[model samples]
Target: MEDFEQPVLSVRKINKQYGGGCASCRGPEARGLLKNYCPVCGTVYACRNISFEVYAGEILGVVGESGSGKSTMMECLYFDQEVSSGEAYIHSYKNGKANVFAESSQQKRYLRNHFLGKVYQNPLLSLKMNFSSIGNIAEKLIAAGNRNVKVMESRGKELLEHVNIPLYRMKEAPKNFSGGMQQRVQIAKALSNNPPLLLLDEVTTGLDLSVQASVLDLIKTIQRELKISMVIVSHDLGVIRMLADRTIVMLDGRIIEHGLTDQILEDPQHGYTQKLVQSLL
Candidate 1:
C-alpha cells in the first residue's frame, strides 16, 4: 500500500449544522444538552464532526441514504455550502499546510478552478445548458488562464473523446443531449483543468442501467489513466464496490463504519451498515 500518512486530502472534525446554535443547544443549563440533535432549537446536524482522508490516486466512497449528510459533506468540500467548524487540507494547496476552509474567497476561487473538480448529481447545477459541449469544457480552461482558442478547442476535443462523446456532437448544446450524454459532458468539463481532486456526487444516480455502466467504466478508466484522487458519494453499494477502494458508511449524519469496500460489504460492523449490506443482498 502507498504511504497514506500524507494524504492528498485530509479532513478533520468538519461540522455543518443548519440552524443557529442557540445557547440551549450548547448546554442544558440554558435548555437541555442534546448530543447531535437539538429538539429545542431544531438544529439539524447535516454533517457532524465528519473526518476522513483521501490518499493520492485513491477513490474514497461515501455511502449513505438521503438525509444522511453524505451529499452535505461533498457540498462543504466543494464550498457550495459552508461548514460550521473543522479543517480541511489539500496536499497541493500552499505546499500542503494551508487550510482550505480558511482560504479567502479569491484563493478559494482559484482552488476551485485549478485544484478541484466536481460533478453534481444534477447537470443543471453543474453545466451551462445553453452552451455547446466544447464551450462548456473551454470555460473551465479559460478560467484556468488559457487564452488561446485553438489550445482550448484542442483540449476540449481530447477530453470529449476521452469521455467517449461523439466528436460530431462537440458543438451541440448540452440541453439537447440525453441525461447520460449530459453527464459525460459534465465529466469532460470537470476534467478540463486537470484538477488533483475530483468530487462526484451521485453522478450516475438516475441514469438507465446501461448508461450508468458506461459512465462508471469511463470514470474508472479516467481514474486509472490520470491517477486522480476522487471522493465519490453514492447510496449504491454496487457503485461503491465497483469504484471505491475504501468506503465509509454514514447514518443520520455520522459515519458509522469505515474500511475496505469488500470488508465493509462482507463483514459490516455497525448495525446500520449491517442492515444496509443486507438490504443490498
Candidate 2:
C-alpha cells in the first residue's frame, strides 16, 4: 500500500441524532445514557461525536454490531443521509479546507459521481438488476459525463474482466447471476470512474465462507493495484482483521477504541474492544 503524510479524509465531531434532545439527557450526565433510548423524549442517537482520519491508500475499518452507528457513519459519508451536526473534509475534493457536510446538493452530486464509490450490503441497492452487466457499468460512466458508447462499453468490459466476471456473461442481468457475481458486478460499477475513495458496507455478508474469502481477496487485490483509499464497515471482526490497516471499534454510537489492526487484536484497550477480540478467538 502507498504511504502518505496526511489524511485523505477527515471527519470531526460528527453526530446524527433522532428527535430533539431532552434537557435531562443532553449534557455530561447523559454521556453514556445517550446511547440508550431517552425515556424523557424518546430520542435515539444513531451516532454521537464520531471522528476519524483516513489516509491515502489505507484501508480503515469501522467495526460494530447492528445499531452500533457504523452503518450510520457510512451512510453519512456516502451522502445517503445527512449528519445532524459536524464537519467532514476530503483532501482531494477541496484540499481538506471545505467542509463536505456543507456542500450544495449539486456539489454533493458531483462529488458522488466523480470522487466517491460505494458498495452497499445489498446488491439490490448497488446494482440495477434489470440492466445488463455492461449497462450497469455504463450508467456510472455516463453519470461522470462520458457519452461515447464504444468507449463506455470497452471500459465496462475491462472492469468486468478485472473483477473476474466471465466475458461470456457480460450481457447477463445481475438478477440472473449468483449473489457473489452480483457483488462483483457492483464492485466493477463502483470502480467504473476510478474513484479516489471507496466505501464498503458489509460487502461480504451472507455469502458462503469460500465465496466471502474470494470477495475479500478481490478487494485486497483492487486496493493494491489501484492504490485507492477505502473505509470498510462490517460487524465481522475477521473481516476487519483481514482487510483493515487501522480499525475503529464502536459501540452504542460511540467509538470505544481505535489503533493498528494488529495492536487492537493483540492488546485491546477498552472493555468492549476486549470482548469483541475475545469473541473472534
Best of the candidates, lDDT: 2
TM-score, candidate 2, is 0.97
Cα-based lDDT at residue 32, candidate 1 = 47
TM-score of each: 0.95, 0.97
Give the per-residue Cα lDDT of candidate 2 at 257.
91
Estimate, for each residue in 1-281, the C-alpha lDDT of model 1 and write its tens digit: 43556798999999888888676665323244354567887887788779999998999999988888999999989999879998999987887899898988888889889999999999999899999999999988888889999999999999999999999999999999999999999999999998989999999999999999999999999999999999999999999999999999987777889999999999999988888899899
CA-lDDT, candidates in order: 0.90, 0.91
Q: For candidate 2, lDDT tens digit of each residue in 196-233?
A: 89999999999999999999999999999999999999
Best-performing candidate as measured by TM-score: 2
- Superposed on all Cα atoms, the candidates' RMSDs to the truth, in angstroms, are 2.4, 1.6
Clashing residue pairs, backbone N/CA/C < 3 A, model 1: none
| Model 1 collision count | 0
**How many clashing residue pairs appear in each of the predictions shown?**
0, 0
